[model samples]
Target: MGVDIGGTKILAAVVTPQGEILAREKRATVAEEGPEAVISRLIGAIEAALSLAGTEPARLAAIGIAVAGMALPGEGVVAFSPNLRGWRDVPLRDIVARQLGVSTFLINDASAAALGEHCYGAGRGVNNLVYVTVGTGIGGGVIIDGKLYCGACGVAGEVGHMTIDVDGPRCNCGNFGCLEALASGTAVAREAKRHVAEGAETCLPQLVGGELEMITAETVFQAAQKGDPLALEIIAQAASYLGIGLANLVNLFNPELIIVGGGLAHMGNMLLSPALRVIRERAFEVPAQAVRLVTAQLGGSSGVLGAVAFALQQEAEVRP
Candidate 1:
């Protein structure tokens, strides 16, 4: 069993030993209602998946939860989640474990996605890789020598927080010029809102019916597809920053592959082509030439499937 808890929704799945998803369930997080409400919804989702699979709780080997934000997997605590309202030092793992009388563990969503990609998706058979999900925010997971590197504290794969520009816009994480602040979907929309507010000449306003607040990264992409100059420029700038972030990863890890996922990846070449060009211009030639950037094969299911992998791996580690 695997569950993924995000800011907006919760996903639960029953996965086979071979990484096949047998059944799954999803529900709104409604995080603003507080931790208790969110936890209840999470449990409900898990039970729904189990029911969908027609399996009893005792029949499951384990449950792994992948959550957005900082989770201390070893400690079974969600130390802090910027997106989960009122979630701090919450004992999510233990709570779920106790509630269902089933073994449960926690992992960062991005880290889980990385493990999922490495084990069953884009990074399969690769010894070193990074899985980066670019959406409302940017998150990453680094696999070194085919092992997940969680750093000294188990929260290491925070590629989004890396500083890109020393003097750029502020990020929700309170950092200036962080990669997430400049290249994420939120950043894309933020840029568009600014342009629209300034009365930029583009079809963006028409796309959102003059409601600047309705502009989103998807809206920008839609406009760009129609050759809206402002929209094209916004995407170009975001992709450039993304490329810079990837270049830094290349120089730092020298991974053989980098898997890009999440909502923004839907732009395909429009986003990746420019980013690849920037990477070639900036990163060391040797590493740049060796790294292959590709889209994730597993889409939204990556995190949940990764949770499944984590549960199985942890279980194996503890088996007598």
Candidate 2:
């Protein structure tokens, strides 16, 4: 069993060792009800999957959880999650393990996604690879020697927080010039709103009825598809920044492949083309040419499947 506890939703799954979802369920996190209520929702989701799969409690070996936060291994506490509001140091692993009566563990969602990709997606057969998710925010995870890599403090591949410009827009991470500040979904919305405020003519204003508050990444993507120059410019700028950050990763890790996932990646070659062009231009030719970058195969389900695979790997380690 595995769960991906997202800010607004929970995805629960019974998965096999190969990252296949035998059964799965998704439900709202309802986090506004606080930690206890959120826990109940998580359990409900798991029970739903179990019911769907006809699996008994004793049949389950272990449970894995993937969450987004600044978490330390063996701590089971959510240090901080901007997406999950009013949360700090919540004892998540203890709560789940106590309620479910199973061996349980939690991992960062990005790392879990990386594991999923490495085991079942573009990273298959590669000992070294990276997973880059460009969604509401930019996140990354690293795999080395056929295993997930967690940094010394466990928040290893927080590539989104890397500073690219010292005086750029302020980021929610309380930092200026972070790559995410310039390239995340929030950045796209901000850029679109600014352009609208400047009286730029586009279908976005009409689509949102002239309310800049209605500006969003989805709307910007739509506008770009409609050939709105301003929206296209914003996306291009974001792609450029993404390329710069990827160039850094390529130089540092020399991974065999880099898998791009999340909503922004759905733009397909539109979003990937510029970033790929920039990464190739900036990174050293030897390693750059060797590294293959592609979009992720599994969609939203990757995190939960990866978490399950992680638990299975742990179980195998303890046996024999």
Evaluate model 2: give its lDDT. Answer: 0.85
Q: Report the lDDT tens digits of candidate 2 across residue range 1-320.
A: 98998888999998876667898899998777877788888899999999999996568888889987665556877787887777788888888888888888778898888888888777889999989988888888999888888878777999899998999999989999999898888888999999888988888988788787998988999999999888898899998898888888999999888899987888877778888898999999987898887999888987897788777777687673
Query: Against the true structure, what is every candidate's RMSD?
Result: 0.9, 1.4
lDDT (0-100) at residue 282 of candidate 1?
Answer: 99
Instruction: Output the number of the TM-score-best candidate.
Output: 1
Worst 10 residues of 2 by lDDT: 68-77
Candidate 1 residues 1-320, lDDT tens each?
A: 98889999999999997889999999999999999999999989989999999997999999999999899988989999998999999999999999999999899999999999998899999999999999999999999998889898889989999999999999989989999999999999999999888878999988988788999999999999999999999999999999999999999999999999999999998999999999899999999999998999999999998988888888888884
